[model samples]
Target: MSDAAILCRFEAARSIVRDAADLAMAMRPPPGGPSGKQKSAQDWLTEADGAVEALISERIGALFPEDGFQGEEEGRTRTGRLRWVVDPIDGTSNYARGRSRWCVSLGLMDGDQPVAGIIQAPALHETYTAVRGHGAFLNGRPIKASPVTDTRSAMVEMGWSNKVPDGIYAAKMAAILELGAMPRSGGSGALALADVACGRLDGYLEMVINLWDVAAALVLLEETGARFSPFLRDGGLDRGITLLATAPGIATDLAVALAVPLD
Candidate 1:
């Protein structure tokens, strides 16, 4: 597709993401309270999750019937060349628990790499978007990753995968701490990457995260001048992959600390 077509898709995605975020915010439960069941030992699934995903899929499909879609709740619908990756609520556990750190993530891919994306955290009143080389934005203003060079002063968010072994999570955390940087986990990979995009967090690390979870944020991070390890493009979609998105200064050090294999 031409650049103009991709930009149009990018604009369309921004509106779709906004609508999805609004739906999620409306369905969000009261603070400090939750009404949802466990999808797994720790993973959560709420009525809002499916409701939001369905709305996004329906709306986007209506606008671009020829485009494919993949959502966290409904899985994949392959119809054509372009694929819309949607995470109705990136932080389900936090959303179910009434925390304000989750977001609605939407991304478009042409073949392998992302062509456009958006991550909107309505609860936090923050919206991030990017079109391949068009730069990234937060709340309509341009954003950039942190320029900090020292690991000692870096603040990185370390995400844990429920599917991974307990030992791996522990080891990764320990590795980050040993590097003399503070490590934290906000329970949402999309939001974490958004934070990295806007320089709120210096870096983000995750052992195994889904494509829907980070697809939008991935583009945002890239456009914001943040560095990241190989994700689904290298055939890690169904199998998942270790992820590292960070300021340029910490990329190599972080990979080394986590023993993340470089591609």
Candidate 2:
């Protein structure tokens, strides 16, 4: 598609995602948190997820009838050359608990390539946007990955999912620690990856993460000069797989330590 076409979708996505964030914030639970249910161990599902996704799906569908949509709540709808993949409420656990870490994520894809994306974290008052070859941004300012090259000084977030075995999780955690880098887990994969993009964190790795969780962040990482795994090349288009995104300085070493491939 032409730059104009992608930019059109990118602009529309920013507005749609912002409105979705507003809707989510209004429905956010109080300090005590909401009575959310679990889809699985540590995997939360809340009313806002569906509501926000419905709004995004409807708006995107209306604005671009020919584009496809794949959302966390409703799954895939119409098919088109450019697909909109959304995680209406990424970090639902945090959102459920009224924490300031959740976000509404939307990504534009051309086949397997993430062409553009918008990730809005209303609670944190931060928004990240990126289009392929156009660079990434935090709020309205341009952003880039950290220049830290030392493992000992780098901080990496290791995302946890119930889908992976306990042993596997432990092994990866140990690997990160062995690298002498500080390791952490922040519950939200998208935000963690976003953190890597804007230099808040050096790297993010997850044994199993879905397309919606990382789709939007892919372009952010790319435009910010962060190195990441070849997720789609490794079958991420059809199913969940390990994901490792890191700064260029630390990417090679981090990938080896975690046994994850770099793109």
Candidate 3:
């Protein structure tokens, strides 16, 4: 499809998620309290997540039925050459707890490369989008990565799902602290990546993230001139160990400091 057509679909998809998020915010649990998916001790899901996923899937199916879909709440479906990766509600834990840091992430992938993306943080009134080769935008204005060069001057964002071992999370935090940059956590991979794209944060690191979580934001980061690499040399979709996305000139230095081996 043409870029304009993709943008139209993206906006429509974003609106669906935004409305879902709004409804989720006013939601109350039943007598038993909130329902959740115990994927494991650390990973989780909620009714809102599934609801948003259904909404996105329905919209995408209606608009682009030939495209495949891979979503956080729903699994994958095979179709044509195009695939849509979606995180209907990223940071579900935070959402379940009423934190305002969650978002909806969507990306259109042509084979393995992202061709279009959109991330909408409804509570924050922030929307990030990009079409491959068309540059990135936040609230309709173009964005670029921060020009921060020295680690000491940079403000970094990072995250680790609770699934990560406590020891490993602590060690990574310590390593980041040792780099002399201030660290912040937004609780959402997609949002943190959007921040990097808009120069709100200089860099971000995560121990592990699914393709659906990062696919859309990765395209925005690339279009905005941000850089990223896997935490290990072989850390691709297959390995899924770690990921580090950074802004402009800071990527190499941050990767070196973190000892993250690029693919």
Tens-place lDDT digits, model 3, residues 1-263: 67786676666766666665566555523334335766776466887787777877887888778888887766786566788888888877677666677788888887777788888887777788888888999988999999998888889987877658888878777777887889898788889988998899998888877788888988898898888874323444433557788876777778887777544
User: Candidate 3: worst 10 consecutive residues by lDDT?
Assistant: 230-239
lDDT of 1 by residue, 1-263 (tens): 77898898888777877887888888898877666988787688999989988988888888889898998878897556788888888888899988998988898888767888888889889888888889999888999999978889999888877788998888888888998999888989988998998888988888888899887888888888888877865655665677888888777887788877444
Model 1 residue 221 CA deviation (Å) reads: 1.7
Error of 2 at 13 (Å): 1.5
The TM-score obtained by model 2 is 0.98
Better of 2 and 3 by TM-score: 2
Could you tell me every candidate's TM-score relative to the true structure? Answer: 0.96, 0.98, 0.88
User: So what's the TM-score on candidate 1?
Assistant: 0.96
Candidate number with the higher lDDT (2 or 3) = 2
